[model samples]
Target: MGLLVNDLSVHGQFADLGSFAEAIERLMVIRQISLRFGRTLHCHRSLAHARVTATMTMPQAIQALAFEKRRAFMLWLTQHGPFWEDSRKHGPDDWIECNGSIVTDSAVGEAAWCCLNGIKQSLVSLTPSSWEFSPVPVDWVSNTGDKKSTGVVNHWTPAAIEAALQAEPAPLISWSQLDALAIARCTRLTFAADAFAPLNGLPFVSGAAQRLLFVLETLNRFKSCFDVAGQRTPEGHEIYHDFFTGKKEEGGRGALFSDSSDEEKSKFRSEMTFQHPADNTMSLFCSWHGKVQTPQLRVHFSWPIRADEPVYVVYVGPKITKQ
Candidate 1:
């Protein structure tokens, strides 16, 4: 009854990139979804295209979508898209169609994929189904059991997912990909603020109190470390760099590491080196951090296209350490 593609019935079928594009186009019209304010004048016409133009690549589009909107994209596809329910609409090979390509052929792992070659569908005169997918991420069970989406689609019901959780409401600390962009109407951005609450207020807090805070701090510190006027000691080193994103020094602050669990520090660094080179506003995870962390959370920042939009993200996660 939850999000999973593990039922064997859906084992071989996957929605590739093109299928993703098609579904996104339809969902936009069906749900009256708009990225019109997303990036360009053309967004009023096609949200998918608008996103690609704004980010300049398909992967970037996935990374750039605000967490909620991305959730919408996945929800509408797996739960409510026309072809997902009625196999009749799929191509002869069982793959969903987009510009005559096989979209379902691609591998299905962490995210949803769509195929589109500049197609459009208008829902104004059509009827939609009562069983619709929600605009939130899902965790599913694949054939191997217990597979989690990277929050790429709606409640996956193909038997791959075994549980259900959304980014909305009061969520416990768990691994969510969109943790960085997640929003709460609050006055404090710090983990200890009312929005984050007890987790931050705990008595023994220190060492990157939370993944979100550490992620943000890492970026800020990274920026400061390389700033034009910033200093490099006589030893040709940046202490802030070594402390925030670098390895643990004998005398360094253990507080800089990600302490998902109260007991130990996580090995997860920040993924900035690969994604953001010279770009002032880009974020991701550290290469090693993924191995030791649990209830995963990662946030990537980008240079805002407009003012007052300095830092934004895609939501998802919890910050707990390994056992």
Candidate 2:
């Protein structure tokens, strides 16, 4: 059984004030990861919107995946974590300390506040008696009217999130008991856009972009596959359906598609597809006090199939010895 947030909070009651403070300290890890996620998501979406007619390169897809992976972490934090408002009302100097160092960055502080707000917001979607956050409506599609859109929906209205906070509903997870689950795992997943070659472009767009769009569209098709309803289909058979059929313009089948040259098609199957398992790995990394660390405890973006690795990979860190 999972440790309920309420119980975890109560556990703090048995410890000294120092431990209580220490418990809150670890929350920085969660907060930092959420901030990165939000920033990346915001940046990528903005870029993709601007480059609407252009082909999405591997670099763009990697960044987009990075953003999504981060957003998911933020969702996890808000849906499951304990947060307390900072008592300090003044400048950065008046702040909490973890491991004898003062926490001063506005970035970290801003992320903490956003995370707390997210937690309050989540209660709006839950039934009072239910311990878990409410599941998203599977069939709920946005009214944006774009046929290929599968962007996330805003489930809780602002007023509802506010009401839940005002009532002081139970938290998703209390201080001191946050898991290394997905968060920790995401920190270790390696992401490199340059790992792939520049897949050839089609006359219309590029064969690369088409394949990428195909995977993105199909990823959400089986979202409800593992639901409470225990309907059984053939093993690995779910990969094929409306998304893959030649009838759909987006599907890769017999559409007016054939990116590879006739000469190329006869020689090699140039493009490939990727599928990630349910419990795949996705990790993010950073450095603290000059040592490399996976502070946020999250996994790498789930790896795409062989045919569509990201286009460009960006590396940020201090110099290190090559092994």
Q: How large is the C-alpha RMSD of every model relative to the true structure?
A: 20.7, 21.9
Q: After aligning candidate 1 to the native by TM-score, how far in Å is the CA of 295 from where it should be?
A: 24
* Each model's lDDT: 0.28, 0.24
Q: Cα lDDT for residue 69, model 1?
A: 66
User: How many residue pairs clash in all the candidates, one count each?
Assistant: 55, 31
Considering every candidate listed, which one attains the maximal lDDT? Answer: 1
lDDT of 2 by residue, 1-323 (tens): 00111111121131233332232233333234333333111111211122211243222332433455545434443443323222211134323222233333322222222221121111121111122233211121112321221111211233433333345423223111122221232232233432122221212211122223223223323222333344423421444332222332222122211122344434432221122222136332211111111111111123222222221111212212111
lDDT value, candidate 1, whole model: 0.28
After best superposition, candidate 2 residue 12: deviation in angstroms? 41
What's the true lDDT of residue 204 in model 2?
Answer: 25
- Runs of candidate 1 exceeding 4 Å displacement: 1-33, 39-131, 135-323
Task: Give, for candidate 1, the lowest lDDT window spanning 10 residues.
Answer: 114-123
* Every model's TM-score: 0.19, 0.20
